[model samples]
Every structure is written in structure tokens, then in C-alpha cells.
Target: MSVHRSALCRGPYGGEGAAAGGTGCSDPAIFEVARHGRPPLPVCPVHLGPALLMASGVLWPPEIRLIGRVTGLRP
Candidate 1:
């Protein structure tokens, strides 16, 4: 038998959250793949709750981009 190791939530934002010692919240629920990478977290930034970044087969990039443009955030 073989077992695969899944990723973990760094934090609400990404690795920084993890580095900051954030354990992440349980609102929208974390998925196997969602935790594997950084950014596009499975939680709401406002409430620090779980949420899906995608909606109706479309990704919510505009909002993220806007944040980056305004804050000059790379990730």
C-alpha cells in the first residue's frame, strides 16, 4: 500500500501566515490541493474564514490583482 502526503495551510495569506505561526481557520474548509500551494487561500481575508476563491468556473483574479496593484504585494 502507498500513501501520499498532502499540503498544509500556511495561513490566511500564504507562507507568511504560516511563518507568523498562523494555524489557519476552518470556515470554508480546506481542500487537499488548496493547501499544497501558496496564495488563493481557502479562507476569507475579512473574516479569516474558509471560502472558495473560484466562483462559477471563473477565478477571482481581478480582486486579487487589485490588491496587488494597490499594496504592491508580490504574493
Candidate 2:
């Protein structure tokens, strides 16, 4: 599913009366993400960091220790 031109962020937001399982964030999307055979989805800058971090963790497991070195983290 390609993201529409006016797509909003698909990140999770915390609040009451939010969509059944959706984030209440109505921020405009700044990026399009496609992963694991999934269609592209829109994402806003505010939520992009966490998405990228999660992707990194999945792509590079902690046991590898390469992520920390590459990112300049002490871990």
C-alpha cells in the first residue's frame, strides 16, 4: 500500500479516546517506510527516530556489538 500524498504519521501515540490501536498524532508524514514485505507507510519526523532505532535493533542484534561501535555508543 503506497502512502498517499497527504498521509499522516503512523507512529504510536499515548492518550485517551485515541483510535482503537492507532496513535492520535496527526503530524504530516516526512518519510515513507517499507519493510519485511510490507507496503510503504508514512511517518513523521517526531516518530522517525524510534522507528529507525527499532529497525536497527532488529537488523543488528545487541550481541553483534557492531551498532554501538558504528554509532559511537559506549555499549
Judged by lDDT, which candidate is best? 2
Candidate 2 residues lying further than 4 Å off, grouped into runs, are 1-3, 12-21, 55-75
Alpha-carbon RMSD, each predicted model: 14.3, 10.8
Q: Model 2: clashing residue pairs?
A: none
lDDT of each residue in 1-75, candidate 2, tens digit only: 233546666643321235422365676666654444343444566665565454322222212111111122385
The list of candidate 1 runs beyond 4 A from truth reads: 1-5, 16-29, 32-75
Candidate 1 positional error at 69, Å: 35
lDDT of 1 at 9: 37
Model 2 is weakest, by summed lDDT over 10 consecutive residues, at 62-71
| Candidate 1, residue 68: lDDT | 13
What lDDT score belongs to each candidate, Candidate 1 first? 0.31, 0.44
Task: Measure candidate 1: CA RMSD.
Answer: 14.3
